[model samples]
Structure formats: structure tokens, C-alpha cells
Target chain A: MLSRKAQYAFRALTLLVDKYDQGPVLISDIATKKKIPIKFLENILLGLRKADILESKKGKGGGYYIKDHPSKTTVAAIIRIVDGPIALLPCVSLNFYEKCKNCDQRNCGLHEIMESVRDATLGVLENRTLEDLRTGKETLAKKG
Target chain B: MLSRKAQYAFRALTLLVDKYDQGPVLISDIATKKKIPIKFLENILLGLRKADILESKKGKGGGYYIKDHPSKTTVAAIIRIVDGPIALLPCVSLNFYEKCKNCDQRNCGLHEIMESVRDATLGVLENRTLEDLRTGKETLAKKG
Candidate 1:
């Protein structure tokens, strides 16, 4: 399941993707439009900014905007930034590997099964970009 | 990510599947083999029993055993039972749908994308069974 924090990130990002090239959007506007709590959104946006996925302006009409084109941002990247490993088991994680205290990954049945699940999930998340998501089209990735 | 509880549940279930029809296996043996805390394994086993996935026996030669053939249980069912919904977002969940406070599911871009993700994930999880996991085989469900 997506963490609440990650969900808020996606909600906010989708809004920004919609408003891309239209100048910065106010945090208040995003919070209001997305129905996220203003305070919680503040931290989420700040984290995204630091990750270089978002940029912010201060004072006057300044707010937040995507740093790169929405088309360049994949859901997998955002999920990793906000929610860490995409793999359900740490032992199977590509970027966030951590040996399980109890099981040997080499022979663990669950490890083998979760690896397939991880690949299947990444097939969608890695291929679909914020632009694709914003368009809300059936442009699902063709399996390679 | 899979919760610690769910991870433990999988570890325990895999052991029971291996021992199925071989007579009941002691809780202590499972705990030691899987490296789960005995008290924690006890509760997990009890829950599986209530769910009719496992049956418990008591007395000198008693323990726990899978109630059904391992091949009959899919990974998706286990995850749902132990960790709740497999969908990343509640609004996209088939069995555990909930209205998003901020967005209309019919129009939300993230909702559309997540629906795809949920489908991709279930492609692997809903098809693979405890038996498949036990064999550590690459019998991943081909996209249909």
C-alpha cells in the first residue's frame, strides 16, 4: 500500500502536472484543490523540492512547480523518493537491499515470488510518467 | 512494503505448506526454523486458524498444519488477509474501495494510473500460490 505521505505527494504532483508551464502554483491553492492538510502538504512539498523533483518560489505570486517536464517524471521515481523501496521485501530490493534477519534470499520461496511481483509492479510504475497520468488515458505500457 | 506482521505470516505459512499432510508441526520448530519470535508466531498461527487457512492440534504430538492444499492459496489472498488491501490507493481497491477525500475517482489521473498498477500487481499475486512460492519457481503468470 502507498503510505499516506506518498499519496499526498502523488496528489500534489498530479495537480502540478496539470498546471505545468502555467507558472508556480500556490501551496494554499494546491492544498485547497487537492484537499490535503496545509501543514502536512508543506513538509511533503519541501521534501520534493529538496529531491530536485520540484522547485519553489517565495513571496508575491511564487509557489511550487515541477523542476522537470512532467513527462520526464515516472511514478516509480516519486514513489522511491517518498516511500523508499518498491520491493515488498527488503532482501529483494534493488536500491534499498537489506538482508532479512531470518531468511536466506538465495533459497527463500517468498523472496523468489516477491521478485516477480516487484518486476510486474515496476512494469507499470516505471513506464507511466506524470504526463501519462495527468492525461488519464489508457496509454498503458506494452510489455517489453 | 510488506508489514513485519505480514512478512512473519508468510514465513510461517511457507513452513506449514512444506509440512502439510505430514502431520502437525510444533510451534517451537516453526519459530526456530523461521527465526520468528515464538509468541508472535503463536498469534499469527491463531489468526490463520480463524481464517481457516490452518488448523491447530493439541497434546503430546500436536502443532499446526495447513487446512487446505498449498496450491489452493494464492499470494494475493494471503497479503489481503495479513496486510489488508493490495491496491496502492484505497479508491482503486476492488475489495477495499474507499472514496478519496480530495479527488473524484472517475476523473483523477492518479486513480487511473493506480488502477493499472493494481492490475499489474494482482497479475502476479493473484495467480501465484503458496505452492508456487514454495518451489521457488519462475511460474510467473504470463500477461493475459
Candidate 2:
């Protein structure tokens, strides 16, 4: 459903959310706890910070913290911030839109069908917040 | 939502299903019509044949055809056969199970949460068939 990068971002965010009130959590602590590579995690956190999803403090006491409440941060936001588009196809992507070279976007049945899948996927991810993920809540009701 | 291989598989399957009675449709014809790369598509069709999703003929006029009705072939089945497990996490995967190295599988909270997400994702993909996909029907119900 998500790339390795997105998974890493989610894990890192959840870890931060879990320790948000405990002052800034160090990247090393997060890497060790999550079993992710420290250097790779460093890059992910930097991307998140650049996206403003997280804030970093660069001292002995500083590590990383959420810039906003976990409840306000959706999985889709984190994924898009770290991995660009949530949609599999560039043609159907809302944030990273690009027309397929061989496609007639207006008339192609393939594009239409892919769009539905993309929308369904986005609806789920966009509505699922970090709070929901951390608390194990079904934030978005199952689409029957 | 799907890999390029899965998308190509679906297109190839649709073409075969549509022309199944017309004898095995040539790989060249399917690739041309579907606009998929010939070499990549050949490997995909071979994988499908190995998975029993497709049957292929060798020699003159040899091509491929769906081994079963389009409705019998689920997106999940095709994706799993072509792309391995449907779940993003090996720990959460049903068909391709792997225990998390650092966690106790029996009581891990992360595993429990991932299981729910995996189930939800599979519920969507497994219920969708090539027939539904080819007809451009949205398999997921609208979220209110």
C-alpha cells in the first residue's frame, strides 16, 4: 500500500507521537526502537522536517517532534511529503498530475477506472491520521 | 495501488478474455493493443501461465488465453502471483508470512494494527475481479 519510505515515515512519526510530551526524541533512539537504519532514518526525518510534518532540534537534548498534533497529521500527508504522489499512476494523481504520453485522458476508459482506484486509496489514506494509526482506531469506516 | 506488472497483466488478461474464443491471441497483438512493452509483457504472461491464471500455446499462431472466467480471477490473486504478497509488511502478510525480528508475534501491538490494515486492503483487492476492473466499475463502496 505504501513504499518503504512511507512505512519508515509512519513508524518514525508514530514513535515521535508516542514520545511527544517527553521532550524531543533522538533520531538514534527512534532508529533503535523501530529497527530502521539510522542513516536512512536521518534522511526520512529530514524530509519530514522539510515538509513541516516534523521539527528537529540539533543538540544533545534535541532530536525530533511533531510540528502539529498527531490527530492533525494524516497518513496521506506523510506519504505525499516523503514519497510524492499517493496515486500509483501519474495520470490519476491529484498532487503530482501528469498526462500519460499515450493516453487520451478524457476518453480513455483505463484512466477512468484507475481514477476510481486512486480516489478510493486516497480517501482511505487521507482520512487516516497518525492518531488513528497510533491508537489502532479505524479512522475511516470500511467502504462496503 | 498496483505495480506496472499487475496493470500489464490485467490488460493482457482482458485482451485474452475478450478474444479467448478466437483462439489464442498472439503476444504481439496483445502488446500492441494494450501498449505494453513486448519483452516485459512476455515475462508477465509467462508468470501468469505458471500461476494458472493464463494458458499459453507454443509455435505458430500460439498465444495466450484466460484459464478461467474473468470473474473467477481476483485482483488479489493476480497481484499475489505476479508481485508476491499483497501486504506491505512481511509481518502482516498472510501468504508470505515473516515474523518481525525484534517483536513477539503473539502480543505485538504493531502486528495487530498492521493486520487490520492488511485485512482492509485485501478485502478491497480480493473482492475485485478482472470483470469488474475491465468494465470500469468501482469495487469499493462510497464513503459517506
Candidate 3:
């Protein structure tokens, strides 16, 4: 499952997607609608901007907007920016990984099994884009 | 996607499973091997006992043991006991649900799509068990 930060980021991004083509949206407006704290949201948006998931403007009438089209964005992208890893275990993680502390054996059985779950999890999360999530489109095509 | 508690519980249960029919394991043994904090694991074990996933004895040479066969105990059952809902969104939830805060329509497109993802996710996690994890079997079954 996603973390609170990831959840809030998705909610914020969805709000942005709902209004992206409509000029910039104030962080306050998004926070108010999303029931997230404005200060905390500002940091979240800042993180998103740093990751290039969003672009921000300052001063009056200035706010944040998606740098990429919603359809081009994936929940995996947002999750990576916010939570750092899609894989549950460090052994299977792409962006963040280290040898499992408990794994001394090169052919550790636990790692092998976790890798499968990891691949399945990443397959689902990475393939589904923001557009898929927004439109409720079944993009993966494969049945579980 | 599992919590520290769930992850610890799963590891502990798997350890017990690995030592199946060897008699009960000491809490200290599980905690040390699984790298879980002793105090926190105690609480988790208590909760697992209440859920009937495990049974405990109070005397010396007694700690914890799986109540049922490892294959019979699905990861979902353990997770549900530790984490409230498997789905990321309440609208996507199977057992626990509340209306989406911003959406008035149950037929909202977002709800429909997330539900599918949730179902797919559940299908995968719920079917996996400690036995599968222990033997590292069915690794290819999850290939996308």
C-alpha cells in the first residue's frame, strides 16, 4: 500500500489533473478541497515540483500545474517521487535497494519469492498511468 | 505494501512455519531472527493470537505456533488483522468503505477504476500464503 505522503500526493495530483488545463491552481484551493493541511501540502507540492511532476508559479494568481499531461503521468511516477520505491522489499527495489540484511545466501529463497511479488506489484503500479487512474481505464489488459 | 507490523508478523509466522512441528518457538527467537523489536512484536503476536492465526502457551518452552497449516494461512488474513483495509481508497475497499469525500456519485469514474485495481491487487495478495513464501514457489505465476 501507499504511504500517507503518497496518498496525499495522489489526491493533490488528481485535483490538479481535474483542473490542469484551466490555468494555475492555488495550493490553498487544492488543499481546501482535498482536506489536507496547507503547510504540509506546500511541501508536498514542492517535492512534486522538484521531481518535475509539477511546475509552480509565485505571486498573485500564481500556483501549481502539472508539467506533464495527466495521461503521461503514472501513479508509479508520483509514488517514486514521494515514497521512493514501488517494491516492498529493498532486494527487489529499482531506485532504492541494498542487500537484504537477513540474506546471507546468494540463492536466498525469500528473495526469490519476494522478487516475484515485487514484479507483479510493479507490473500493475508502473503500467497504470494517471490517465488510466483518472478515466478508470483497464490498461494492463492481463487478467490477474 | 505491508506495514512494519504486518511484515514482522509474516516473518514471524514464516519462521514458525519453517520450524513447523518442531514445537513452539520462543518470542525472543522470533524477534531476534526476524529483526523485529521485541516489545512491538509482543503486541503483534497478541493481536495475531486474538485473530486465531497463532496460538500461544505461557510456560517455559512455549512461545508461539501457527494454529493452522502454513498453506492455509494466506498473507491477506495476516494483513487484515494488522492493517484495516487492503485497498488504498475507501471507495476501492471491499469490506470497509466510505463515500469519497469530494465525489457525490457512487458511479463516479474514479471509483469504478480504483475498484478494479483493488480487486486485482487483492486477488494476488490474498491467494499468496506463508507456505508459498517459504518455499519460494510460484515465482513465475506472477510474471506479467
**Cα lDDT of model 3 by residue, A29-53, tens digit:** 9999888889999999999999888
TM-score of chain B of each: 0.90, 0.85, 0.88
Q: Across the candidates, what are chain A's individual TM-scores?
A: 0.91, 0.89, 0.88
Interface RMSD of each: 2.8, 4.9, 4.4
Error of 3 at B36 (Å): 4.0
Candidate 3, residue A96: how far the Cα is off, in Å:
2.0
List clashing residue pairs in candidate 2: none
Candidate 1's residue-wise lDDT over A25-114, tens digit each?
999999998789999999999988998899999999899999998888888989999989999888889889998887766667787778
Query: Which stretches of candidate 3 lie above 4 Å from their native place?
Result: A104-110, A133-144, B32-35, B105-110, B135-144
Native contact fraction (fnat) of model 2: 0.10
Error of 3 at A136 (Å): 11
lDDT of 1: 0.85
Count of backbone clashes, every candidate in sequence: 0, 0, 1
**Between candidates 1 and 3, the TM-score winner:** 1
**Off by more than 4 A, model 1:** A135-144, B135-144
Q: Per-residue alpha-carbon lDDT of model 3 for B1-144, expressed as tens digits?
A: 556676677668768888877889999999998899999999999999998988998898888988888778876677788987877677667777766665644324445445655766666667777676564443444423
Q: Scoring each candidate complex against the real one, what DockQ results?
A: 0.53, 0.23, 0.29
